[model samples]
Target: MWRESSNIGRNQTSSYYVDNTLKHSFSNKTTAKQKSNDLKMPQPDEPYYCSQQIQIPPALPDILKQFTKAAIRTQPKDVLGWSAAYFRALANGETPPVKERLEMPVATQKTDTGLTPGLLRILNKQLGPRKTVDLNIIEEKWKDLALPKEQFDELVRIGGFGGTIEWLRYFALGCSALGENITDAMKTVCEILTADPDGGPSRIPFPLFKDLYTYLAKVDGEISQEHINEVTSHLQYYVDKQEGYVQPRNFTSPDCPKLS
Candidate 1:
């Protein structure tokens, strides 16, 4: 009796499988019908994927920092103020000054304010010397490839990228020199803080600085510790400035009288 019951159960299972195969064949025909219906559908009165669009905040810190660096490096203090005003205007969703009147994209749009060239020159001084810098290249490459605000803001918290103590010090001094807007330098420091060969926490602190000096020293096939010392000396200047009362520290002078 048990063996007969087991055979009956197996037969039921086989019947179910055969029935499923038939159902699937019918399901494919149903899908085809659904596709045709979809093709013939009328537009809705208010067709939207979602009832409400999501709102994302702009990258305030990165925008502020990069613009500030470009401004200070390219222009005088007065112009830096104008640049700051322009940066604020953009941040607040106002039209910026124009450079031949073009539209800005939602993600990577820029207000011209007619002063971008000046700022670009300053940035170029530090990150340029491009082989063939052109208007299109500046508009497309530099503007487009700049670090997004969030990533840069993250770097400010993480010390900085490329593992260079001197670069970090440069940011510290630049921040201090900028007075109240030193947060700008902090943002810049954050953007590239982890662009080193060994990304994340595994990198040595001063690789870029030391490597740069070494590369320069070996240009004529000979290296020297003098270059290293010079780099060290410059880094020391910034370290000393931290002892003072500045909100963000400045690079210190080696010749100044020692503080008690």
Candidate 2:
């Protein structure tokens, strides 16, 4: 009887140990599964957060944005130097220096005109020995060219005696627009104006040359008769000699014809 009771107790202890082990394992598996399901997934709109914090600012102002875009487009070589100069100018309450405006290259073939450097030298000599002349005189002479008033003023402000040469160039361009061959006309006009009293190349009187040029443009139908009338009306004294001929008293001398 004692041997049988001992065997039964041993069997019960073994069964208890096996049941405890299985229960513990099941509990652990259940806990792990619960943890996996409880964990939350992130929404699409939310930004991912790692260890670091990032700060984003609002949009920039329109003017500042435009300037930044322009700078990016230009792509200057020395960005830091440009920034320094820009800041310095701003601190000094002055405008920063900007790059010059680039003009598109014209591909038209250039025809040789008598307005060469040699002719320019002669014209300059005729204007007198002075390096500069009254800007008003040039402005008055070419007023009929009909360039923008502001642009003409700016040119006069910047260009000294050199402005006269620029005016002639501009006049040639204007005449070209009217279907007139300005180079040939300029050659003829210069020859006529420089013709001398004693049969030598002489200094042309500026006022007389201006009057003759105005007449020539009108006669060639480059400018309207109404335009000529308007110009003559502005003069203090003018005489109409015949059709397509006019004389300004100040330009007429004893030697030069009254009608130019």
Candidate 3:
């Protein structure tokens, strides 16, 4: 009987030990799994794919921001007019008239103070009766004239002289005092008007001529009624006789007489 009791006791002890061992193994496995899950957690510095946070883009440069604002505020309504003024400023080796300080000069008669007949004569002699005057010629003549830079700039600004058309008109108006024998003047103006931007013969749209006339009339009282009449008549002739545009040939041909 004693021997049987000892065997039973041994079995119970063995069973208890196995159960304790299993429990310890299971606890260790659970702790390892928990540690692995903790390591997988995202750090504060790392952005998670599932995160709802949004990053803002960097701001524009101060200069760029200012330029954008200025552009928005000062956008021109008349693109052609603006272009003319801009180009004229560039041709004169001055800053473009788009700046706020360079407002369009007042179109009063007092503004015509410096445009003397002598100056006009000088320009006429330089341009001559050429069918197409080079832009470089006009620019060089402008410098040779040695007119006050400030005054000339003011005239250009007020006249809204944007391109070759305005430059020609400015000289023509100044020369109007010489009477109607403006053959060379008419030819030069026509050349500039009809010449292509890339070089070669092109047509001058009537609307541009009209715009130029209107602007010139407002700026200079010395521009005679005959000048206005002649310009209108020529434009009408082109519309009726030629196509809606005036080509270089039209100006060079005998049909279009000198601006008398």
Which candidate gets the maximum lDDT versus the true structure?
3
lDDT of 1 at 19: 100
Relative to the true structure, how large is the alpha-carbon lDDT of every model? Answer: 0.40, 0.44, 0.53
Residues 1-260, candidate 1: write the lDDT tens digits. 99999999999999999999999999999999999998996978985765357454577668767665644443342554456545655677743322222223222113222223323223333333343333333332223324233433333334333332333232333322222332333323322332334233212234443443343334324434664466455555544553311211221234422111
lDDT of candidate 1 vs native?
0.40
- Considering lDDT, where higher is better, how would the candidates rank from best to worst? 3, 2, 1
CA lDDT, candidate 2, residue 160: 31
Which ten contiguous residues of candidate 1 have the minimum total lDDT?
244-253
Output the worst ten-in-a-row residue range by lDDT, candidate 3. 97-106
User: Taking the tens digit of each residue's C-alpha lDDT, what string does model 2 give over 134-245?
Assistant: 5564453223222245645543333333433534433333333322353344333443345345344343444544554564554455666565554545432333332223
Local accuracy of candidate 3 as per-residue lDDT tens digits, 33-142: 99999989676896566444655445546644654453344354444554564456546765442323222332332344443443454455445455345545555555
Candidate 1 vs candidate 3: the lDDT winner is 3
On the 0 to 100 scale, the lDDT of residue 53 in model 1 is 77
Q: What is the alpha-carbon RMSD of candidate 2 to the true structure?
A: 19.0
Q: Give TM-scores for every candidate, taking all chains together and pairing residue i with residue i.
A: 0.19, 0.21, 0.29
